[model samples]
Target chain A: MATHRFDPNFTDNVINSMGPKTSPRLRQLMTGLIKHVHDFARENELTVDEWMAGVKLLNWAGQMSDDKRNEGQLVCDVIGLESLVDEITFTLADEAKDAPTATAILGPFFRADTPYRENGADIVVTKPKDGEMAFMHGRVMDFETKTPLVGATVEVWQASTNGLYEQQDENQVEFNLRGKFKTDADGRYYFYCLRPTPYPVPDDGPAGRMLQLMDRHPFRPAHIHIIATHDGYRPLTTQIFDRKDKYLDNDSVFAVKDSLVVDFVERKDDPQAGLELNYDVKLVADAK
Target chain B: MATHRFDPNFTDNVINSMGPKTSPRLRQLMTGLIKHVHDFARENELTVDEWMAGVKLLNWAGQMSDDKRNEGQLVCDVIGLESLVDEITFTLADEAKDAPTATAILGPFFRADTPYRENGADIVVTKPKDGEMAFMHGRVMDFETKTPLVGATVEVWQASTNGLYEQQDENQVEFNLRGKFKTDADGRYYFYCLRPTPYPVPDDGPAGRMLQLMDRHPFRPAHIHIIATHDGYRPLTTQIFDRKDKYLDNDSVFAVKDSLVVDFVERKDDPQAGLELNYDVKLVADAK
Candidate 1:
């Protein structure tokens, strides 16, 4: 066999050879990826055992993901990668940073084709409710003009008080705690559901094990997911966090933006014996 | 919900909370990983779409790996991460850097329990061999003392001229071109097999697609893998490359070290119609 030496130019040689004819975008992305990944391994002086362990982790994460669960997304979340990407992609102009509603991660639990309900309709389809009832009322408006956006579709979903989404808990009815509402003439939308409560993300997979190994909790702050869309306006996907939830200070997903937090007012005299939450969403107009 | 602000401290808060009680090694690994991943996203201004693309790639890589295939390992190889890790983990002391045999990646194709063959025995188990025959002879010695090590187990395996290992090509017999041999008293060992040839890595999976997208070729240079172990010496796993191979300078896996390259001498008068190769291995002793 021929004997060759180990030179420092190995990385550049590999990069140059691998990206000769790729599209400019792909070339740029691959170049950055190669440099960062190579630098990361060298800087850490990573061992073969560590590399193999990572391989196993990735394999486990892939094998654990399915229609109802996405461990890869969870991996990104646990490492704060998703949040960083969101910050980079959604950072608003200095003057409008606080004007528009802050965006958060579109977590793995979201589902499409949710049933649409009328304003003030109850979305808790499960029988014999086990958690405190709550009403969430909100308005959707154009960011700059503050004009109500009538006919805006407000899609909402959240985990039950027990910390499990409807799809994750077999006992809950299909589409439980999930529904869509259309804004009325005044750009108002309302729905009745259980109060949001802090709940642990699924801890049965590699992602959960990763959290355990890191000495970190898997709980996300009590929050309601919202995706609002209207013609001529950019879609807004965010979560409204309950300020009192303990996990807010250390959300496992790093998705807690201050502007996305709000109060859940206790109403002891209400017939529903639950809390009331009011939130307003401001969305940017879609660029022409 | 309570109106909270988007604090810039979120990343630090998560990092601090997640690593308090972990082992020092785990803490360091996690800390560096979190920081680099976050920085990569932020520096590149990674978009949500781009992040999702990454997630999809990871998912595909994971799902594509199995008993006979390892897409994750291939992903690392393509990104130059495995080579970097190997470099860091196996780097020799400055004084002896050039004295010892160089190490290479233990690729996904390596399998344990290969059958042992006697010295000068042919490892090719297939009938009517299509490629020219070759003989590989080498000696094992201590790096500093230059003393031969007897009874050293030298395991060897390589793809056929068609660029497929026995396991990857079912038409070939089990353990074809794979054997383990013990060195003689003089630390000499020899085996007969087909000449190695450059072949493309498996491209039917996500890893292959990644290479195609990046316009990168998957062909590794013509080479043979060797793993030698002895009683009082550290095990060495490496590959010897054929210097004349077209892909020598651009091995798809980035595993070509300068010292691991060698000549495949053609013997025109040999009845077997093959080439001869000679390589000497220098091993580092096990720590006392």
Candidate 2:
């Protein structure tokens, strides 16, 4: 019988042949990628059908992507890859004792060039139907010094209570529920918006099919996304999850960090019948 | 700083949630896939840019694939995954010691229901431009008995010397280099065709870009594909490589098996002005 055992030199041959003259960083990345992927296939004894299924899923996800939607990013998020990579790469240096705000995946909905507004500006241009108003106020501070970071840029966005971003729903005004605000002299920023509600990710695409096949829900917990930046501090991108959202413990993207969850206090007497949430952001110093 | 170390339970959480009610085999597969992918990301400290680049590559490959071309399959082939899986899954049973023919990937080009032709029939319906003629003859035998298997279906195909398959080139007639022949009572089958030539895989897509980035050649060695099937014997799919082909040692797909390589002898006096090749295929029985 012919030898069917694993070839000892296969990995080396593939790596050496494919990575000879690329940039050093590219070579290193490719080598590690090849080794891990090859080892995974061998260890799993992956069958042809399984491999073909994976290819088909990826193909479908690609086909589903468009200028406004990124199905591939959704796939990565659903598979927990986006969050895992974010966690790994955003780890703070050990010497910094104070805890900075945790990082979250910059999901596919982010759009640049949002119009800047003064602190405490109401971001909701058209009130969403069946949506309860909410006031999200937060303070931006330096992690090391505990000093307020005045004039910090706080970019905030979240899906409507209907779980659709402005770009995704034609009924909503352009850039609805999206705005940029500056921290006041007291280092506080606030925006009036609809309370986020737990919603399923787009379920009509290949990523949704993958989630279904995996027996997992496609829901992400109610959350508000924020990107806070100051001149002398590292940019902080994170999401604040409502403490009462049912999907918090089982966020589809695995992006819910304990420190990023906050409670929204119900303010029944308010004219808008709004909820109030206060969160504090801490940014790491840019350098030693 | 907050704990940024690897979440010890993260792997288990993903696996358990994603695989709760899936089939046992699927559960096992998903579990392994999640672990390996997460571990690979963490180990490589994969940057966001690198991850997004991979996503873009996959997206491009999917967009490039359609009914006629399989860019995703090409990606798998160039990554050496198709051949690796074929090798692992096609290993012969230990008890059936007689060496059966080796297997290769059923590439994306294979189409079912090809028309059958009589023995000694020439498969090249249109003489390819700048192509050298070749006459290929082979016998199908039972591995254990060394006896001919009559009435076996021998399907054959190959790219022209110009490195184009019939479907790929408009000038070539439909099914030009593709045909099926039946073995005679002596288990012999013969067909006239062009000598297979080394060819670059379609390099205008994502897979090609990957090859270029890796500093690797995209050429597959010269080879002929055959699939032999008899009523009571297991079907054998394989490729016969031209021993003199320069790419034999470094086929883009890593499909060059030592046992599948053969010499193509030149015939000076033949009317066809062709090369002659003889291959004997040994098929294992269906059951003990």
Candidate 3:
């Protein structure tokens, strides 16, 4: 057996141990992070067994993640960490009535290298028998000048009406419900695809268990994910949530921003289109 | 793109969302944990990419752990989370001069079902050519009564002189340097094994990279781990640290305590033994 002593300066000792070569940002980040984590554990009198349980849960999350899924980010999302961080980073401190549309959680399902499509092209590779046709048209404009930003690229993705992303459904073809469209001379982008439906996050992993413990539902409101970029404007990664979805107010990831919510309208002219959304994007200039 | 609004009650919202069915303790723990983690992120104004990188790092740590090694715990160890928690949980609020000896981290290497050995038995299976033999004798007693605790089990384990625990080295025999011995009627336990040498934590993983970034060394000082348990008393998991080790003050795990330090003396009687150590133990009865 051994004796014990309280290190009155345990936090300082750890923070100071950082090598002089460490960048100031890294040191500051680690110092704050460690202080918070240590304070939490100490204040709670966290036991070794309880701490080990957390380690095991994290391990389970890692084991459950792969190219098609990321349980790691899901853990953060379910805990409100991803949303909180999104708020902290994307929200301008200035109280500017308008900035570029606020960003949203990219989530774990975004796929890179999606195929580019011409305006009005369909991203639906294999539409469900009961799926409704939906069209979205939008213009990208500078927030301050209210002027068009020509030739912007709007990369878009969404789950199917059946509530599954391409990677999660083998019936859907490669890059299903995903496309990148370039704005026309009017700075207007146009495309059509199946309307997305609310779906549950993968509920077999650690986040699922966490939700179960918290007695919270695991559903995210139906939404379209977008990454809009122009030559001199700040790039945006965000989601357009369906205003009618029941889960919007209680989104499992807490990522619903009222501005990002849009109501679907009945298609008036195109017999092929069952619904339509007309949403415009506002962009902020890049920081110097 | 859509609109945005700041939930002034973001932190409180998250804390209040916990279900009524959740155990009070779990709710409290989660609330505190989420508060600290959220406050840290918000205060730092961590960018999305930086937050994602941290998530990826935690995932990497999880991926590096398995049945034989746990990088999750190691991450906590190097950052002093585990040590801080140990101090908070095990350190009594009262200033009692005499209590049971203190505890140390039961690092990832501990295995169940270790073979039991008779008193004076050896744990070293295949010693290194330059390895020195060492013997340890210990007595377990009641802290308040100063009376012997007979028939108690003292479970001990150590890395070989080569600084590799059996599980980490394929060349080492099964359960090498691991054994449990029962104390005699006098509350004394005895065993002989190879002297442990300073060893580095597995540094090929995320924790390793963290240490590298922090400009910190990864080596823990030489020490023997023990878990002493008896019926009707609190169990004790602790360490006997080699006093002469250079890293004693800067142990990589921050586990070194003044009372746990012991000097190894030259063996006078046994030509087969290179060093000898005698450490006693004290136990506090379990609380009612």
Candidate 4:
């Protein structure tokens, strides 16, 4: 017998065989995804055995995720897919100037809303034993015009003194070291809270294991999380890392920026600032 | 002053943080995605320097693709994402028994519909001036019952005697050695053609370059393309390969199977067989 030949558009036939029209967007997405995926199979000359192993890895990734934790996201970040998408979204805003604030990944720890309080308030109502007190103040303004954005809202949050988000540690207060403050007529708002310390993202997950297997480190630098907003301004999601932290250059979330780094000045017993120490912030409005 | 903490589900504030309420799905996807992306940044301690390099890589992958090729797919495939999705879809089929024929990637060469033809006809109407004539025969069947599937239509195509798909070789005849054949009453189909030798997938593309960089090979095993179908029975889109080919176990497309490998016996002069070749095909209704 000679080689009997034929065309095998197996992929198109199979996908088309799935029936009914899909939205152009979704179709384009799936099609593009499929092409890349299939091309990969061809390019690697992937064997059946190797293909099966990939399936098992994904299953393990899924198993590592739960209500209290999601390891899948961590894996995505490590593999660079998360950053790729973030870069895309970040670019949608104006690129001419420094982003009003450093736009960074909103780490897995954020929960919606902190209680709103008047200016010059504290977020750490019940202080956890571990972290120190830091009084933070910030004013929101248009980056180009340098005009203060009065009535702007600034939400601040941080891990408990034990170096964990409230959700991650059952022992911590429900929303410890987290609060919402609105700027006064001068576009200034202040809040006091326990200082954040370097913490490790859950290393028990598949992502952590991969990092370990790959010999990559997992510590994130200390940082205060903030989301600032004002009318006609693009909301800014950012973090302020301690300049002295060891992992500042390697903040696992890749959120650090030169301008966003702040010194946690020590004021042993300064009561005039209403707390043991004071920190100041200059906010830039989210632009169109 | 103190940090004012609130409930984990601080509806009034965090809710207000997101301008317009997103659909539950969008919210879930975005939040999960954001967290993971941010986490990756944190874990890698990714700095602005490294982030720029990543952006550059993505741009390169994108620029590598064009109308005649898809490099992005190749990159994703090598990373195992393509196989992950393929396996997921395979496992999630409505019924394991209803699986369609083992589907593989449609290489970039496929161009819509090839010219259709009649039953028991030769597809390679014009053979390479230097290649030897060979006769191929096969029968389409229901794999589960091992019964002949009469009246089934089989469409076939392949690269010319040189072993290059039509789109890739401008020197070869357009739609060369490509045609369709309907299975006879006895479920047998035969055609006159030359043996197809093993060939390399396009290596000038990004996938090829990546393979080169990774020290991987690009050769696909010798195989004949065939698609068998009949109404009421699932369509079979598959290929039969010569077992002796060097790339059998390492098909770039991951398309080979134990059952798909068929021996191509060498035949001497036999005028009665009209080119001295015998071929048979065995097929099953596209797996449920």
lDDT of 2 by residue, A18-60 (tens): 7466777777777877777777777777766678888888888
DockQ values of all predictions: 0.58, 0.60, 0.67, 0.03
lDDT of 2 by residue, B90-160 (tens): 65242346457888887777768679998888887888678888888979999889899999999998888
lDDT (C-alpha, whole model) for all candidates: 0.82, 0.82, 0.84, 0.58
Model 3 regions lying over 4 Å from their true place: A1-7, A92-98, B1-7, B92-97
lDDT of 1 by residue, A221-274 (tens): 999999999998878888989888898888888899888999988766768547
Q: Name the better of 2 and 4 by TM-score.
A: 2
lDDT of model 1 at position A45: 68
Per-residue lDDT over A22-72 for candidate 3, one digit per residue giving the tens place of the 0 to 100 score: 888888899999888877887777877778789899888877788888899
Of the candidates numbered 1 and 3, which has the greater lDDT value? 3
Number of clashing residue pairs in every model? 24, 0, 4, 39
Q: Output candidate 2 Cα RMSD.
A: 3.2
How does candidate 2 score on lDDT? 0.82
Instruction: Kindly give the stretch of ten consecutive residues in candidate 3 chain B with the minimal lDDT sum.
Output: B1-10
Most DockQ-accurate candidate:
3
Candidate that beats the other on lDDT, 2 or 4, i.e. the better one: 2
Instruction: In angstroms, give how far residue A84 of model 4 lies from its true place.
Output: 3.7
**Better model by DockQ, 2 or 4?**
2
